[model samples]
Target: MTSSIRRIPRRMPGWAKVLTAFVLVLVVLFAGVRLAVLPGLRDLFGTETQDRSGPALLKSIQDMSRYDAASGNFQVVVDLEKDAKYLPDVLHGSRTLYVGAGTVDAYVDLGRLGGNDVTVDADRTSATLRLPHARLGKPALDPDRSYAVSKQRGLLDRLGDLFSDNPNSEQAVQKLAVRHIGEAAKDSGLTARAETNTTDMLQGLLSSLGFKEVHITYRS
Candidate 1:
């Protein structure tokens, strides 16, 4: 009778065993957090913001001398990206998508009216007024309405934010938003509408004051 010999398997190396165990532990922890813990934590701490700001101060106020005849509401989506000269975006780049909402006012500077702008005819029944073209005011951004849709930062940028006081400042995006709003306002014919409204207002007022013929002209 031939005797059968049993061959034993080789044992794994200490480092290999340790590595395998560590990997398994990591997988289990990740699964636990993702499947169970995170949801509970998020429910317990919903996205609620608290305001702790101090009362607003009353600064010096200036009287407004312009008539806001027309206002244009505008919204813009800004996509900004930055990349390193020789590095890939994953390593040293950032991309942001922002949604901005604002308003631009078209006005006539009544303060700029000249003494000789209004001319009365000798008959006292006709008058002529020379006015400057309507001008657009600065873009006024609505803080409560404007918001960031998304933001992506590279590994280096994420690491740098750990030491930064204000990591997510929206100054650049906000400036871009204001610029876009201003551009849109310039092309929207808001100033022309404002001029028409102002002229109509003046005609009605002058006619009520017994002027039958009211002639209004705009200068550059």
Candidate 2:
């Protein structure tokens, strides 16, 4: 009778151990499915979100850049809502005029007219300008057009050309910018919901001018 009782307890222990092992295996499988398999499937088959307005914005920027040099009446309308945090003061305070040929000249308020002129050469290779307190050297102007400088080989020019040549480059840049913007919004205590408002405002203004994409980098 005592031996039988001991055997019953021994059997109970074995059964309990088996049940625990089975539960552990089930838990592991459940986690694996939820964490790994589902995410993999979604990445493989999910529909990509496309920004439909990008093309129109890019076209507008290109058109603004292509203004005729003879007219001297070109205007670049910036969408403030999309890029207000970084662009508002610059756009409203400083006036950037497109010189009929290909150059861009910006004049900032210094309490007087013609106080300063920051000239970005036509080829987009170099810049020449006189700031309020700083003086810049004269750029070597191209013989064909006395007002604009010849295209120079530079790191920035090379990178810009690379992005222009590769389709993936632009997408990569957009992704990076979006990530940075998200981070900025978080750090600034701004809600992500505001992004839509900014993007919409920008789209409206850019669509009118035919700009498909505007890549902005903030400086100190």
Q: If scored against the real structure, what TM-score would every candidate get? A: 0.77, 0.14
Tell me the RMSD of model 2 versus the true structure. Answer: 24.5
Top TM-score hit? 1
Candidate lDDT (C-alpha), each: 0.91, 0.34
lDDT of 1: 0.91
Q: How many backbone clashes does candidate 1 have?
A: 0
Model 1: per-residue Cα lDDT at residue 196: 98
Q: Runs in model 2 with CA error above 4 Å? A: 1-168, 191-220
**Residue lDDT tens for model 2, 113-190:** 142344444654443333232111112212233221122222333334445756212232233333443333334322
**Roughly what TM-score does model 1 have, to 2 decimal places?**
0.77
- lDDT over C-alpha atoms for residue 200 of model 2: 49
> Candidate 1 at residue 142, lDDT?
99
Q: Which stretches of candidate 1 lie over 4 Å from their true place?
A: 1-37, 43-52
